[model samples]
Target: MGDKLSLPLKPFRSRGGVKAPHRKHTAECESVVMPPPSEVLICMSQHIGVPCKPVVKPGDEVKVGQIVGDNDAFLSVPMHSSVSGRVKKIETVTMPNGSKVQAVRIESDGQMTPFEGIKPPKIETRDDFIKAVRDSGVVGLGGAGFPVHVKIGVERDKVDTLIINAAECEPYITADNREALENSWGVVSGIKAVMELMEIDRAIIGIENNKPNAIKVLNEVCREANRDMHGNVCVLPLKARYPQGAEKVLIKVCTGRVVPEGKLPADVGCVVMNIASIAFVSSYLKTGMPLVTKRITVDGSAVNRPQNVIVPIGTRIKDIIEFCGGYKCRPEKIIFGGPMMGLALPDDEMPLLKQNNAVLAFSEKEAARLEPSDCIRCGRCAAACPMGLTPPLISGLVAKGDAEGLADNGIMVCMECGCCAFACPANRPIVQNMRMGKSIVRSAKKK
Candidate 1:
């Protein structure tokens, strides 16, 4: 491994990251559960693994938490029905990235019924605990849809620390913060469960210092549960910073450990999980209900009402907006997550996925980008890159289609967190170029 593949020990700090506006309008708003949508277009590829195959055909009846899609692949987790309904049709739908994926549309009966066979799984053994998590269908609920079970199902001896990411670093996203406030017990219990079952000795809950309420509540709850927990648990208050919630950055900040390139947190003797994901593990272990509904922050300048709500995983974007009193004005752009590192949606009719933590509708003033000017040899982009990547160099290589050159310069290490784009005085599309450079490098490697 090269220098870029490691973290600096003497520094005891992670590299460059940017600070953005903290537009947390709904940070104090409690989450309300939205009524079931008329129908849900549940996609098969919600997680960052193999896309599941639809097991139930059109017209098949289903209850909430019933398996609708599954795959034999080890990386994939089973997908559950979000509402009691009948499958309308199985069709291929285009995602925000313009890739087509199979989706199952279900006509909701509004019954809100749970599956008849729902019950908590037995967890007498470590394998039992892993199986329960896999059956729960939870994933990285903060934003990335990495399967949760796959993260926990690692070699026991390889891991000694479990890090819970409660740092909702992105602006306008308070869903995770609410989780810490509303269900602090769940957060503590979930951490203890993982630590006990996995035999981990240390657990850290990383929260941005801006969320003092969340930090207060979580610390109180963890203290209350100190006698019940198997190992030590600390609620570490992190400095408020963008990309603070990113796994790699969180690992470095919380534990001073660096995850090597092409490796995972577990490789560095740690397991990092999103706050909501771990909370869901506790809920599922108690109630046996799988992941179907997700908490979302509905806000932005275009929103009529900025609030937090819990909606079914497959609810349409427009429906969620309507539930929030519709738009304040015509939205020029709709983003899936936060302003930074979020995907722009081509259509709002597309259903919500498991990983989406926020639905942002932006007015023209907020969404419009300044015309990019020539790079003036300014190093702000490099200074802001969390992975120490030079976006200008990567952009040049991408323009020339020099994939090997991009690879040699550690372009693949770029996390696409948009720190460069946010820091650029020239308004350059460096993050987009970084994406292209990584794509080009990946394609060349495939060849």
Candidate 2:
């Protein structure tokens, strides 16, 4: 379900994750537009593919939605300026992945001016739709950051069903929920547009049963659609479970289809897009604006105001914290997403990326770490893993440097969803070991 899973493997546990607490603190707080950050650091490598090269040099005045970084790579999408300002400088910055890429620092003029070149795309054909999607800079808004255009640009016959993922199962994240409630029409219009352009058979919008309001709003919108816009789209309420929002997990639960390892949803006659991503498509098609802002939930024990804020891309985490009434206490950990699979940034200086759905800051007590104890071999980790892989086995292989065994056991298939770590009474760092084991297997392959 995660990007780390690539190897083909045997059947996995259809349901093998923990029922984590749904810390939907800001579920009812409608999203508010955050004032533009004094400065923004737009990264060149926002998506999963090749990093975009800078198209604007320092001292150039650019407006919102202006193309600032771009690459010709099919897997890549253009990066646009989130604010109207002068490019202060272009500097090589370290990304969370430990790689360095050029980052454009822009001094926002506070006017929130738009680029004159912003325009709605003409979409008469499927190619036009795909191109428009790419031009809109839409990616996986659910935190995958994969280029949406490249994913749905396959043959018309390849995808039979289009799945809209409205299941925001992760804790402390309600951006999708807000989108469903506020932009129900946008979500439905997006689905209708995609289905028409791609010639897909039907569309299913999956929302967890936990959010009855979101589900109800979506169903009402779909039900009240004009007669010509009816029946092709429907809503399905799913059991709320952690990692239920994972692409493959949602697909299986919604369609009873298991995307084989090393394959994509398209291989199984399906395409999955995040709820917010598709809603943005409808908005972009009308406004011609690229994805320059994001609606993110800001919460945790350390935050003063726990609510959703629509922020410009590249706004620093510190600024966002300030906007959210600042910290109630000194944060020991600042995560860029949900606690389960979110990344803990080194500091608040980091800029928000395209896929960041939530910013969670926890105090030392809330973020406390427990020392790992000897495994009791109770198999909780094994039972908790969605892939049914043995976490202890992987950890042992990583410790013994047995890359062969790790690879044979589908080490790469570990999505690092952290279910094992969460379920382990021993507090074992199984996900960390999986990351290490994956590195060893990668090294072995390269050797």
User: Best-fitting candidate, measured by TM-score?
Assistant: 1
Consecutive 10-residue window with the lowest summed lDDT within model 2: 2-11
What range of 10 consecutive residues in model 1 has the weakest lDDT sum? 1-10
Clashes in model 1: which pairs?
Answer: none
Task: Assess the local accuracy of residue 341 in candidate 2 as a C-alpha lDDT between 0 and 100.
Answer: 90
Q: TM-scores of the models, in the given order?
A: 0.96, 0.95
lDDT of each: 0.89, 0.88
Clashing pairs counted in every model? 0, 0
Model 1, backbone clash pairs (residues 3+ apart or across chains), number: 0
| Candidate 2 lDDT tens digits, 147-198 | 9998899876888788899989898899999999999999988988988888
Candidate 1 — what's its lDDT? 0.89
lDDT per residue (tens digit) for residues 222-274 in model 1: 77787666327878888888888889999999888889988999999889999
> Candidate 2: misplaced stretches above 4 Å?
1-13
